[model samples]
Target: MAVAIAVTRERREGETRCAVTPETVKKLIALGATVSVEAGTGLGSSIPDDDYAAAGATVRPDLATVLAGADVLLKVRGPTAAEISALKPGAVVAAMLDAYREKAGVEALKAAGATAFAMEFVPRITRAQVMDVLSSQANLAGYRAVIEAAYAYGKGFPMMMTAAGTVAPAKVFVMGVGVAGLQAIATARRLGAVVTATDVRPATKEQVESLGAKFLAVEDEEFRNAQTAGGYAKPMSAEYQAKQAVLTGEHIRKQDIVITTALIPGRAAPVLVSAEQAASMKPGSVIVDLAVEAGGNVEGSKANEVVTTAGGVQIVGWTNLPGRIAADASALYARNLVAFLGLMIKDGALAVDLDEEILKAAVVTHGGAVVHEGVKG
Candidate 1:
């Protein structure tokens, strides 16, 4: 018999993106997998039950039945403890699985004897590019961040030389130059904003300049070698951080819009913007904090809230930036999940090899044990 793959509806408040799409349903079926999705699973992404049925997936209403019979279960967010408890002992569950923060859920998966894969742990390697959920989702989040900033700013992004009076172009400053940060810079530039970006990694300076934006950073000796081989930023010395802060602080006051996208797993997000800096910004200026859910990069920024300072500056801290573009995010995320599942599906059945490098990195719980090194205590 063919393996059963199920996609569940997200229960988290404010989570609109789904783990499956009609297009991916066909792809899953082509691999000889029997695909089943919850009745209202794709509604948030504007995909109805009829569409999933048309694509050959069984749309069931009972989530418990769908989960219990699933050989492979897919989800947008991590499965809660209650979710894992509903599945069979040997069921394979795949999702973002926020292992760093959801320690109890990881333990629950182990206790339930379910093999679980955390998409967030998908390795950033050449072979795993198709399975890289972070890149696909972050790309959309970055684009939306610039759009959100533009919406909040009172003035135009591009300069307009009118017969009455010339409108000056908005100045956009983006902190952090990761996947999200790069796309944010590109989107801001596309809107004709004079964009400037900063990052601890020296390699991104050229990338920022290529996007028609200036790169702002204190290029000290430590700055030159700030990135590790794994493409993560290394911590800088206290003196270097202070010097860089002073330099960036002066530049920030002139910015009309600022978007910060710095996040590190298992740690509080680094504070990039101070309250004083926000206060110093001119009235009508906007700040979008992409790392707000991980503890805000901007001071006084609240998750999923637009806070207006006494000076009239606005801080946007939306937790689900990619979900704002629901359709596109769902499509890309579904494709990523399909690609990951493709590796384990063989001869019209489930076949998992824990020795595989990508699987080794992404699989958090397998054979009733916490397998991933980072997540396992």
Candidate 2:
């Protein structure tokens, strides 16, 4: 029998992206999966029901009808409590479940007896790259951060040599040269800004320099070995952080725009920009904090709101930057879901192998219990 897969509209506020696009729906159908989509699921992404219907998915107006008896459920965000209760026992769900923070949602999935996989938990291995939602989304977030900063800044990014006079180019400083920071640097540079970036991970120096951006760091022994084997930034010592802060504080004061994208998995975002740092920035300067939702990398950043400090530094902390560019974000995110779903379907039937490394890492609940080590009590 063909595996039954259902896609529903995301219920999260300000989430405009959908889990499945018509293009992915066609691919799922070709893989022998019976795809059902709730009516208007793709509306926010500008994908109408007609497109999904044309792509071989049954578009039902009622979400319950779409999910009823479904063998697998796909979502952009974690399902709500009522959505979890609607799923059949033994059914599979895959989404950006945020298992690390949404403890109640994980418990609800366990109680509902649904086998759930958190896309954010997918390992950062070569084989799992196609299924890595975090990278795909963060890549866009980085690009969007630069764009947001440019919009918020009163001056032009590129220097202008007008007949009146010469205008200097914007100076962009990116903190935490991870995927997002790298992209922000590239985007700002492409817009003709003078970009400089720093990260705890010493390995990123080459990447930053390669993008024609100046690499700034304290460059101590601790910085030499500040990355995990998985290439994640390891938390630096207090002394190292203090030294780095001094350098960043000086750098921040000179920058016209700053974009901070540092995030520690399962932990609050590290504070790279303090109130003093913001106070030192020039008036009309802008700061975009991609880590705002995770407690903010900039001191005055508020999630989903742009605030101007008393000194006139605008802090852009709008959450879900990927959703701002919904069409492309939805396309990439849906493809990620399709690739991940491929792992669990065999011979046109839902066949989850919990022993698989990707599944083992991502599966937060299975067999009526929270099974992921990080989430289990």
Candidate 3:
């Protein structure tokens, strides 16, 4: 029997991206899986129902119909309680579960006798690179952050020499040189800005400079070894953080635009911009905090809101930056999910191999229990 894979519309507020697309639907069908998608699931991403039908997917109108007899459920975000209640017993669910924060959702899935896999928990191994949802989404987020900043900024990014006078290029400072930070640097440079960036990982300095952006960091022994083998940034000691803060504080006042992207897994985002630093910035300067959902890297940032500090610095704390560019984000995210699907679907059936490192690391709830080590108590 062929595995029944159903993709649902995202129910979370402000989530415009979908888990499946026409391109992925075709691929999933090629893998000998029967693919179904809820009607309007791709509307947000500008993918019409006709496109999915054309790609050999059944587009059901109601959630109940979509969930009916589904062997595997695909979603962009974790399922809500009501949605989970609609699932069949022993069904498999996959998405960016945010399992660390959504404990209640994890419990619900366990109680519903469903197997859940978190895309965000996919291991950062060479073989699992194609399934890396975080990198794919964050890459788009970085580019979108710069686009948002440029829209909010009063001056042009590139220097303009008009007949009247010469307008200096905007200065852009990006904190955290992860996937998003790297893309932000490249985008800002393309727009003719003078870009500089900081990250705890010493390996990022070369990446930043390679994009024609200046690297800023407190160069110390600890800074030289601040990255994990998994390519994640390690938390710095308090002493190092204090020194870095002081340097960043002084440097921020001169920047016309600042973007903060630092985030630690299962922890609050590190504060990179103090209130005083924000106050010191010139009026009309903009700061986009990509870590706002994790308690904001900029002091004045608030998730989903644009706030202007007393010093007149605009703090953009919009969550889900990639959602702002829904079409491309959906395309990349769907491809990532399809690649991961290939690991479990074989001979038109769910052949879950628990021994696979990627599957072992990503599976959060299986056999009516929490399975992932990090999610388990």
Error of model 3, residue 290, in angstroms: 0.3
lDDT of 2 at 166: 97
Candidate 2 C-alpha error for residue 131, in Å: 1.0
Instruction: Give model 1's TM-score versus the native structure.
Output: 0.98
Candidate 2 C-alpha lDDT tens digits along 218-258: 99899999999988999888999999999999999999999
For residues 139-245, could you state the per-residue lDDT of candidate 1 as single tens digits? 99999999999998888999889899999889999999999999999998889899999999999999999999999999988999999887878877888889988
Candidate 3 lDDT over 1-377, as tens digits, reads 88899888899999999999899998999999988899999999999999999999999998999999999999999998877999999999999999998999999999999989999999888888899999999999999999999999998999999999999999999999999999999999999999999999999999999999999999999999999998899999999999999998899999999999999998889999999899999999999999999899998789999999887889999999999999999999999999999999988889988888899889999899998888887
Q: What's the residue-level lDDT of 24 in candidate 3? A: 92
lDDT for model 1, on a 0 to 1 scale? 0.91
Model 2 misplaced regions, further than 4 Å: none
Query: What are the candidates' C-alpha RMSDs?
Result: 1.0, 0.8, 0.8
Whichever of 1 and 2 has more lDDT, that candidate is 2
Q: What's the distance in Å from true for residue 119, model 3?
A: 0.3
Q: After superposition, how far is residue 260 of candidate 3 from its true place, in Å?
A: 0.5
Which candidate wins on lDDT? 3
